[model samples]
Target chain A: GAGVSQSPRYKVAKRGQDVALRCDPISGHVSLFWYQQALGQGPEFLTYFQNEAQLDKSGLPSDRFFAERPEGSVSTLKIQRTQQEDSAVYLCASSRGATGPEQYFGPGTRLTVT
Target chain B: SQQGEEDPQALSIQEGENATMNCSYKTSINNLQWYRQNSGRGLVHLILIRSNEREKHSGRLRVTLDTSKKSSSLLITASRAADTASYFCATDGRRGSNYQLIWGAGTKLIIKP
Candidate 1:
């Protein structure tokens, strides 16, 4: 079976620039999540989506961060005005059910803001 | 912030030895899960143990959950060089009608062949 996939495995953006990371979850996965992991640290939750609805965005750091899963399958995490502090690995994961304990992950997009 | 910590931040052992990692959390959880991540790669789900289950086994991986103490442990028996990686424990907590996983800092394991 196909696993979750993310685009732009590595991204380099200048400060003040905007970046968008894409995630393609496994076929028929209903729950999607986004996380940010700094170097040598665990992943920090960012947002979650149940189908096309954004269920939780409390973990989003600031207004500069936005996410959408318009079709309930593919998702995109956008960071506006990138900052050096925003440099980290952005991870995406999906589960079969809304509250499934097991989740499949994507390779993630490593964002570097210079 | 992380919910708890994984003890022995790092461990190094020879191949074919058993490796054990411990994790502790602060809140009640529905389940605890283990994940493995290799260098520059996504995490792979290793095992999941519900709060009600005391222990579980999958292949060479063994996971134990202690709800009373809010802790868990992952033990890998007869490990191989491929087992060298970071192992993380995630506990699921309530998030409105749903649930979200709270992750630990993870334990780095190094295996010498």
Candidate 2:
């Protein structure tokens, strides 16, 4: 793709339900990142991947939050037993390198848990 | 915890006027980057300044970094209505030996035409 892309631009889940968001980064990009953004707030880092390796997952808010990039190009973020607090925009970004490079972001998925 | 803090939560100016935003951080960084996000859109990379470099320019965007003070500024010259967007600053640093970026809340810029 010309730029990073994400699936299901919007999602609405009932509290206690599970939701999955997907991201397809630019071709051959070596690094990918996931973030959660609240209304009128900046992105909050969730996790990072160098190729298929999950180098850092410290930012995941809780055990319910999980992300994986098994093939390195496409990634998925899964939230289990979603709560109303989980309502936010889920953003995915990719960079050409593993460190210190500008990242390209996707349009983002707005999740609303009711 | 977010390391970078952007000053002036919101800014409004007439078209053709220059706008500036500031960001401050608490720790050493390898580089700092500015990004712009229009309403309901994703962020686009604006410019980057390395820790060793004091300033950089790209088109109408001018970025300055003061490593000693751990602060950076982004100046947009001759702003246009299309320049209306939220601007954020991110610093590349380590969190307990893990490389990641700390982002500011962002400045909402409105260029009124």
| Pairs of residues at least 3 apart in sequence or in different chains that clash in candidate 2 | none
Query: How closely does chain A match the true chain A in each prediction, as TM-score?
Result: 0.99, 0.97
Model 1 per-residue lDDT tens digits across residues B17-69: 99999999998877888999997668999998987899999999999988899
After superposing candidate 2 on the true structure, give the runs of residues whose Cα lies further than 4 Å from its correct spot. B96-99
- Tens-digit lDDT string for candidate 2 (B1-113): 78889988999999999999999989988889999999667999899888889999999999999999989999999999999999999887565222477789999999999
- Kindly report the docking quality category of candidate 1: medium
Give the winner by lDDT: 1
